[model samples]
Target: MSYLVLARKYRPRNFGEMVGQEHVVQALTNALTQQRLHHAYLFTGTRGVGKTTVSRILAKSLNCQGADGSGGITATPCGVCQACTEIDAGRFVDYTELDAASNRGVDEVQGLLEQAVYKPVQGRFKVFMIDEVHMLTNTAFNAMLKTLEEPPEYLKFVLATTDPQKVPVTVLSRCLQFNLRPMAPETVHEHLVRVLGTEQVPAEPGALRLLARAARGSMRDALSLTDQAIAYGNGTLAEAGVRQMLGSADRGHVHRLVEALAQGDGRTVVETVEAMRDAGLSAASTLEEMTAVLQAMAVLQAVPARAAQQDAGDPDAQEAARLAALMPADETQLLYSMCLHGRAELGLAPDEYAALTMVLLRLLAFKPAAEDGATEKKTLLNPAPPAEARPPAPAPVARAEPPAVVVAPQLPEPPAPAPMPAPLAAELPPPTSAAPAVQAAGQRLPVVDAPRRPAAPTAPA
Candidate 1:
């Protein structure tokens, strides 16, 4: 046999072997054990999260016979049985798999429906497994509705799709739908370790962790990248080799870059970018790596316990935590925003290194300057009006009067002002020896009279 690819070689044959998707497995297992089988089933999730895998497992569970050929429908199939072996090898007469991506026409759907009428050749039930069923045409879906909703007692329909939205709601409502979520990084990491162990391929835990993250919740992708890493490292996976293979920036570099950004060290940041460029690392990858680091920093800053638990396996968790402490929440958010936006700048710039340098420097540029220096710079550059231009505000006046009215009132009759008001001096009376006068505004001014001089005082004058 041609060298089996790692993905196919390690394809999960049983639900117990599948990684993640526990909710789906539990429900299916319970249904199988209770013999509460649905005529039609729909599995939805991103690629390689085990939608098709679950379908195949269900097929085997329904048809498998024990080693002595005495088994019936069961949640756990005996691999030694003819039914299980044939299904695992993809040679089962009763189990049929259709690629809707290729056979998506109405005629193809009708052809498959025709097989639904016939009974199982040997097994207790006939299984129809359709992959990428969402790719089927509207007319094809219409053709499938009747049979899918009400198949024969001995026939089962299993449909799998990465996107369930494309599947008609009418069809979706008729089937037992199970959504398989994308596997978490930690879950993917553990799965990789198991696979590598089985293959006897020595791998660094950190290397596997990086592969898991890069896979983005896809098992096939994780396996494919692991294969590449193994090849790159001559069958022994190491962090340095995997990083080189992925063209991914190292966490050490990412940490240093973030630290410099947090500390407002523009020179160091630029120098780091220069080194990355010299090493021929991708600018986009640099930004992406930094974004991941910033995201972790934010999470750590927000929930210490959660971060502690999640980062327990990470060798750099302490460094990451320390960086989180040194960086403020606001700056962390800012740097995250910059890294996200900087990814787009990579394609626009003539040289990615220059783009990266500017992107890293952007954070430093935004750092708040000292209050005194900032104020002085602002004042010197944009000085306020001189004293002559902006004279001291006129002394506070109680009521300001217009020197002259440019436009008179529009009333038909002019306002009457015949009364001659007393002068301001008359408004206030002279001070008297008996009663003193208060001259301030709004105060009562008392009348005053000079005291009469004696006759002897007049002679002396």
Candidate 2:
């Protein structure tokens, strides 16, 4: 018998098996029980967040039959029925799943829509499930708008996409939309524990926590990673193995680095980074770990009681709280921002370890001085002035008066006449008869003269 992977083997068969999507499940369950079904349904979310799974479960709900083969539309499908079994196996005649990513042209869409007129061949309803529906072309979308908006009573449409924004508003308006949120780490962790228990695989709690955080809220990814971890650990998942597999820095190192940074201990910071590098740990991962610790420290600093209550059982939480108290709130925030942005700098540098060292040192370089240290800094920057060699103040001098001279009045100078062109000078009239020359001795009249024109006549002769 061929072995099925955990993701496929444990795929949810009905709404009851779905996880991390209570809001969606409740809404759908109520709608199903009341028979308030829409012609078109759109499920949107990130990858592996149950978009496709929800679509399959919805299809089974529409077509499920009881063991005795006498069932109507139901919120819970009987997996034993031919309709439910075939749909789960992906071989149902009426439940058609189209991968829009590959067959996104108008011809394919029209071909699929061509079947909308026909009745169901083997089930109560004909379900057309289109995955990654956003990949469909504009023309393809337009091709099915009329049918999607007004489908037959026996026909239903299920569209799923990671990016709902790419889907045209026209198509979006024709469907009932449900956003499936990413599962929380805690949710993923609980699910993994159940899954590993079923598989009879022994995994440490710390290892599971690491996997959950690494999964970043994807159940499918968490399971896939568990499969890899089990194989790597030879069926036993341990913290050290998972850490090495993930190239994650140890919490001890992260805590040490944070403490060193808080205390302005550069040597410890450098040593911690070197140890991480020696262990072949990722620089980016180190920064990521520091950012996480700093973030926790910040939260604990901000709301100590609440954070304590939330992280009461976490082994590292106590240490985080300790560091939170040790470092000032402002410095914690500053380091958090630096570590967050420092990850981007790792790729730009030639050596990632060296870059990590620089990023850590950068926080120390910019760390705010303490109150006592501020005074010391001021003294260093501006020392006291010398006292013995101070210069003496000078005496004020007496004012003196200048000697008086005999009075001698002077007359104002006369104004100069303006020059004129020779031709204009020749054409000028004599001084005005109305004016009296030398009426005032200080005012003098100036004469003007024009150049001779005799040379012109001599050349002609």
Each prediction's total of clashing residue pairs, residues at least 3 apart in sequence or on different chains, is 4, 0
Per-residue lDDT tens digits for candidate 1, residues 1-461, read 77887888988888788888889999999999999999999999998888877887898899888878988888888888888888888999999999999999999989888998789998889999999999999999999898888889999999999889999999999899999999898898998988899999999888988899999989989998998888889989999889989999888888999888777788888888888888878788888888888888899899988654755667677777889998888889988998899889888999988888888888777765658545222233666788889867878769887565243223344354334336533544564443432244445444344444323323344
Count of clashes in candidate 1 = 4
Candidate 2: deviation at residue 203, Å? 0.9
- How much is 29 displaced in model 2, in angstroms? 0.3
Evaluate residue 310 in candidate 1 and report its C-alpha lDDT on the 0 to 100 scale: 59
Pairs in steric clash, model 2: none
Query: Which parts of model 1 have CA positions greater than 4 angstroms off?
Result: 306-313, 372-461
Model 2 Cα shift for residue 321 (angstroms)? 1.1
Indicate the worst ten consecutive residues by lDDT in candidate 2: 450-459
Give one digit per residue, the lDDT tens place, for model 2 in 341-417: 98999999999998899999998888766685461222346564578766766888887977554333343444555
Q: Provide TM-scores for the models.
A: 0.80, 0.81
